[model samples]
Target: MTDDLQSWIGRTRRVADEMATPLVRRMAALTDRSDVALDRGAVVPNHWLTMLFDDAQPQSQLGPDGHPSKGDFLPPVPLPRRMLGGRRLTYHAPVHVGDALERETAIAAITPKVGRSGAMIFVMLRHTITGPNGLLAVEEQDVAYLEAKRNAPAPPEKPAETPTAEWRDAWRPDPVVLFRFSALAFNGHRIHYDADYARDGEGYPALVVNGSVSTLFLFEALLRRNPGRQIASYEARTMQPVFCDRPAFLCADAPGADGARNLWVEKDDGAMAIRIKTRLT
Candidate 1:
C-alpha cells in the first residue's frame, strides 16, 4: 500500500516561467490595495503568489468536491479529502513584479500516521522559486489527506484562559471574503464557498475557511504589532479547520529570547486553528 504511494515521493515538475506583474496587480486589487503602484521591478509581498502554476484540467475532470481529480501530479491517495497542513518559507530575496519566474516542485516526503481522530496521509512538497536574479524563495508545504466524513473529536480542554494578550484582534470572515479570496487565488475547492457541498458532501459544520487566509490574518496582525519589522523567515502549522461562521482572533506572545515571535489563531470556540512562528531582520 505504501509502495504505491511512495512512487510519488521523488516525482518532480517544472512550471513554465511567467511574468509576475499582472498577477501582482490582480492580487493587489483583490485585497483592496488597487491604489498601490506596482512597477516592473517592484517587490511583491510575502505569500502573495499562491496559485501561479496550477494544472488546467477541464471541467469534466473535476471531482464532486470541486477539485481536480487526483493522480496527475499528486498521488492518488484513497482519502477523499485534502487540506493544507502547514508551510515553512525562507525568503532568500525579495520577489519583484514583472520578473520572469519559474517554480520547481518535488514531492519531498509522504508519511502515514494515525492520530486521535483516524488515519492520515501527509504529503510534503519542496518548492524552489527562481527569478532572473536567481533563487528567490524556498518553501516546504505540507498537505494532509483524510477520510471523508470522519468526525473530528472535540479539542482537548485548555487551562484557565488568559485575561489578556500582548496583542489581539478579531473578525468573522463572511462568505464574500471567502469568495473573493478563492477568485484571487484561483482555488476551486468547494469547501470554501459552497455551503451545501461543505456540509453534506464534506462533513464540515460550516463553510471551511481557506488555510492561507488564517495565515494572512495572523501575518497582518503581526505587522500591526511590530511595525517596521522585516520578516526573515516564517512557519505555520494548521492544527484544525477554521470555519467561516466563526470569528478568528490573532494572538501573539512576547518576543522570545532568540528574537522569534510566536503567534496563533484562536477560533470562536477557543481552540487554536494554527500555530505560527516568525523571525525578523
Candidate 2:
C-alpha cells in the first residue's frame, strides 16, 4: 500500500468511526420490515461500508497532486456504470430490532473486468456482523462498474428457496418510489442523490440508486407480503447496480424456523440484486 493511501485510510477510519453508531441506528430504522410482534432489532448500513473500507486512506492521497490509489474506492468510477450481471441471494436468518450488533468489513477482491460493455472494475466486499449473543451473519457483495450505454435487459433467472415457518405475501418495487427513501436514509453516495455526478464522476448513464435502499425495499416487500408476521433476522448481499426510474421485483419465499429461513431478492431483469433469509418469531 502506498503511503498516501495508508494515510487516507487512517483518516477515513476516524471520520467513519465518529459516524458509526448514529449511522447504524438510522439505517436500521430505514430498513426495518414487518409489523409483527417479534423481538426485531434494527440494523444500520454503516457496518458494511465503514467496516469494509476500514483501512481506506485519505481521499486526497495517492500522489503528489493527491490522486487516488488502487485500494481506494474505484478512484471515482464512471457514473451510470451498468450492471452486467449478478447471482442469487441467500439469507442465513432475519435481523430483529434492538439487536446490538458489531460489524467488521474487508475488501474481498478487486478484479479489473472487461465485458461486452467495456473496461470495468468488479469490487467484492465481505461483511461480518455479530449480534449481542454471538456471530449473527456474514455477507458477500459484488459491485460491477460496467461501461455505460443504452442496452437490452439482462436474461431472467430463478429465486432461491428455503423451508420456512410459512408462506409470505409477494411484494413489488417500483423505481420512482426510492426518491423519498433516499432522502430519508441520508445516503449521500451521489449515485443515490445526484444524476450529474453519476454520469460525470461515476461514469454511469443514469442516476444510480443506493444498494441499501434496494435491500430495504425488498425487506419491506417481505413484511407487506406477510402482514402481522414479525421479522426476526435478515442478511442481504448487493450483487448488481439498480438504476433509478426503472422497474424491479422482489422475489421472496416461505419461512422455516426461528433460526433458519430461505429468501432472495432480485431486480427487474431478474438479477440477484440481493439474497436474504429471515427467521420469524
Q: Cα lDDT for residue 46, model 2?
A: 21
- What is the C-alpha local distance difference test score of each model? 0.78, 0.48
lDDT of 2 by residue, 130-233 (tens): 55565555655565766555455444434533333243333443444455555444333455556776666655667756555555555555556655554454
Global CA lDDT computed for model 1: 0.78
- Prediction RMSDs, each to the true structure: 2.6, 7.9
Off by over 4 Å in 2: 1-100, 147-187, 200-205, 227-241, 247-281
| TM-score, every prediction | 0.90, 0.51
lDDT of 1 by residue, 110-225 (tens): 99987545678999999999888888789999989887675665455453343345787876878988887787666889999999999899888899989887776677667655
Candidate 1: which pairs clash? none
Model 2 lDDT-worst window of ten: 8-17
